[model samples]
Target: MKNFSTKALALVLWSVIFSFGGCAVMDKNIPGWSQYRNPDKVNELQLASSSIGEGNPVLLIHGFGASSYSWRHIIAPLAQKYRVITIDLKGFGESPKPRDDLYSVYEQARLVRNFILENDLQNVHIIGHSYGGGVALVTSVYLAASHPNLQNSLVLMDSIAYPQDLPDFVEVLATPGLGPLIIYAIPNTIQVKSLLKKVYFNDALIPQSAIDHYAGNLDKPNAKYATLTTARQMLPTDLQQFSNNYASLTIPTLIIWSKDDEIVPLEIGERLHADLPNSKMVVLNDVGHAIQEEQPSLLLPYLQQFLDAGTHRTAPNSK
Candidate 1:
């Protein structure tokens, strides 16, 4: 009887540790995590966000596996002229990554729309990269009827606006049992570096800081689960239906694509440009899918001109 009781206690202890361990949040100590975390919860989730400057609001969204850190280079400059807000989509960055299997693009867009409404952001411009671009597109569609002026313009950089084959990493993550094991086998730094190489046109330009920033807290089991779940549900069930709706969006849009973006491909950008009623597409040579990280300087003039044409010019006093 004594031996049985001891075994039962040991089993319970192991179960408790495993359950808690699997549910740990992404490490909040990642550089800039505290600096950008939003105190207010949008819906029920405490989203990580940074808001700076003051004018017509410009919200920036990062891609899959990225935090607000992805816009680190351009946020300051944009904030100088506009109220720049960058958010980590649910399950990414400092945002709460609940194991709740609800990381769809539509769900992400819903959160973004609420964030805009909750903050009372007006005459907003949305900029999204890769997966975030898809969210931005969906958000724009959602905003068209009720808050047209609020979401006035859009800027998409190598965005995932249309259906396409999944990237190698995405495919691997979307796999059932084997996916998690494969990703977990590699060290976080190594995994991040490997993925970065695939996105950046010139691997030589990849920095150590980038590797460290993106690799933050990925070792946690929740992070892995969130990533896997996101990959599996990256595309909506009615993607063609959604793509058909792109033509209905009349907002002024700037679609920037890298000539060497093997991930989403330049042809998709061309197709997206053709679909939108009012959109201008720019294709830059030699950059990869991460055009923001690679050639932000090249993007500034276009961004400044586009925003100046449509948005309020007066930037309010700094906060």
Candidate 2:
């Protein structure tokens, strides 16, 4: 979770993939294969993603515990207007999880930049939700500073941008002795699954299959440690600072917040819009922090419009 410095910062602080047992740990009950069978031929899912359309480039960034799958609803429609790309940040999903102290927002930003460069993606638009929003902001600053003229637009969805300090809940959750145990029991997949009910305004938005898809990835070899270490070491305030650095960007920007968000409040979104010189804010009424899921129909068209039309317009009644 990432956000600006404020009382609501504590609120936003709250927040994968299904991989089978490894070659050695495969279940023995399966038909004829050995108990320990290779899960599949694939190991590390590259940063590059499946694409759609041939127009402008759009990168979709998923929030905490969510993999490329989180963009399921948006990708198809977004593909109608532009090339849509979704990636699993290093520590989450099928992506490579190198546990050699390699997890950080900068590292993730670097990886994404490298991917964009590797693919020669230009005039790219970043659309991120929650934790991914922080990464998107970092990517924008890094790309604007280093690559210049790469980022064309930014869409931050109920994200954590400016960080004041640790919230009381997180402080207690991160306590020394207890933190380890909590971290151990609640791995990436499980942590996300457990939080899903509260994360989405409507629990029905997340089906049982979705929960399974997320929790299943926790078994991936180094996945657990990668997520925990990143949290303990990579402070979000570091990423939030990147926003201040991007105040001069010429890229058109859009900020979307949910009025009823229990997680990141509208204040963070509003502050971000205020701080960013080239940006607009769209707040959705009757929704939570996870506005996309709580109200996908509300966000989808606006996103499609922004990407296709390159203009920001409120839904008039969004409030």
Candidate 3:
């Protein structure tokens, strides 16, 4: 009788684990999860995206754990003169959360390439921030090798291109066993506030609505799995390997960094500028990693200057 009871208890525990895990794995198929789906791979995941205006195309890619919403301040302003495209990379925002995808920089670059090809964009300019910046660099290299004329200009904002120490929380979250459990248990409000404090130079400038928006995404189904998977694949080694390709980038490149950025640091920006033969660096004062959100006004002039220069150079020569 004792042995039978023990076996029954074991069976019950196994059932609970399988039930929760199965729900997370199957969350991709449920309706009302995402409005945008990739037509090429109906079964696989697709990025949630929005494009506006017309002219030269500009693709905006956000940082790790962030979404297209990160570009909210700049998107519309830029769209007035250019076709601005913003996407929530897979597993970040409203995009599909597939359990099987690797969610690495290389994979994200592939997704960006596919998005450009599917949209039939030519000579698309790319603007990426932090993790997105790393993806932009990889994507630029891939395009230079695969489709030489597909890319125009490249802009990296406080991007993570060189090797550096990962944050303590990120290191902890990347651990094999503890990572999953901690991600699953992290409360939405607390997590949002903590991350904002670390990323923003002035935490007081972070609005409550912004906090709610970020926190709400974290509360989505299977968000924990997506977060953990992304964290696991975000190693500096993956980015550093592409550093050698910077010298080969002939397109007009812009490297923007906040002087006080604690995340990626200003030295990384200097290194990136040094490596890129045709690149220029601009350092903003009194801002942290979240430059777009914290100091959009300061960033606008540099973007305009770069885009205008590209436009002038690419303009048709009068007969």
Candidate 4:
């Protein structure tokens, strides 16, 4: 038995995993797809993705508790000038949510890295927000060391890169037993609206459709398991050690932060700017953690300028 308010709050606030568990089927047409095909593993899901436009490829990774739909406002504009790709990370949106414990930043990064390689995308740029920023950071590190020529630059928005205290809601939902119970017991439209309100600086700006879309996904089977598991692994043990790689990521990078971000403080963004040798930091006012959703129009110009400048930069270590 769970308290109604507690359950609703936990389910709504904590939304957002990792693991290369196993692939169910391998597409013959996709080279190297056979390698991930395994019947024993449960969560190595093929991501649900969409792409539009042409020219340089840009991948957008959404944050915790969000799906590709978060990019709804800006994808079209970006696609007009450059190829833009958006994905529902495993267990979020339309992607499969297995009753397994494979959700982590590392696992998500692996899937993202695989997506880049399988598609044979050249000089790709990744834009990640919040948790997705953590995933983008890991992915960039992996590519810089392994496939240096494939990835060109990185754009992180209020990302979780360094170790910090988990948000209060995240802590509540990450608690074993209680977390899963709350997620399944009281997920509904109201809870979804409550959650979005916290992310957006302007709650009135959130529309009815956004609530319906997110709430609908929470109602799906096994969605509880995925979100709970992801909360558990939100902060990996090797975070400090892993984050040390930030200094070596010399590829052009952009760090975007909201001055009013309540979820992740602006200080973290300043810290990230100090660490990344080849990075620029931009702070947007009157927005919360959900920069993309709140005012993407403010974000587009920086994105275009950064991408244009980075388009021809030699890949990391190309020299």
Q: Which candidate is the best by TM-score?
A: 4
Considering only N, C-alpha and C atoms within 3 Å, which residue pairs clash in candidate 1? none
C-alpha lDDT score of every prediction, in listed order: 0.78, 0.65, 0.76, 0.79
lDDT of 4 by residue, 1-319 (tens): 4678776565444443101111111112221212222212233568989999998899999988889999999999989888999999888998888876667787788788888877888989899999999989988987887888888889999999887877655665676555555556655676677667878899888989999999888888887677777777777766777788888898888999999988888988999998888888899999888878889889899988888888666433321
Candidate 2: pairs in clash: 2-160, 2-161, 3-160, 3-161, 3-162, 4-162, 261-289
* Best first by TM-score, ranked: 4, 1, 3, 2
Q: Which candidate number would show the highest lDDT if scored against the true structure? A: 4
For all predictions, the C-alpha RMSD in Å is: 11.8, 13.3, 10.6, 8.2
Q: Taking the tens digit of each residue's C-alpha lDDT, what string does model 3 give over 1-319?
A: 9967765654454334433432121112222102212223222456889899999999999998889988999988898899999999888899988886467776787788778877878878999999899889877877777777888899999997876766544655666665665556545655676677778999888988888999899888877778877776665343455577777777778889999887788888999888876787899888889889987988998998898788632432222
| lDDT tens digits by residue: candidate 2, 1-319 | 2323432332233231111111111112222212111122232336636788777799888876668876776777778768888888887888887766545455566667677777888888888888788778777766776777677788999887776443222343334444445556444444555467657776667677777777776667786676555555434433444556756655788888887776676788788877777787888887666766656788997887677756332222222
lDDT of 1: 0.78
Off by over 4 Å in 2: 1-48, 165-173, 186-190, 234-241, 311-319
TM-score of each: 0.83, 0.76, 0.83, 0.85
State the lDDT at 115 in candidate 1. Answer: 91
Root mean square deviation (Cα) for candidate 2: 13.3
Provide the lDDT at 30 for model 1: 24
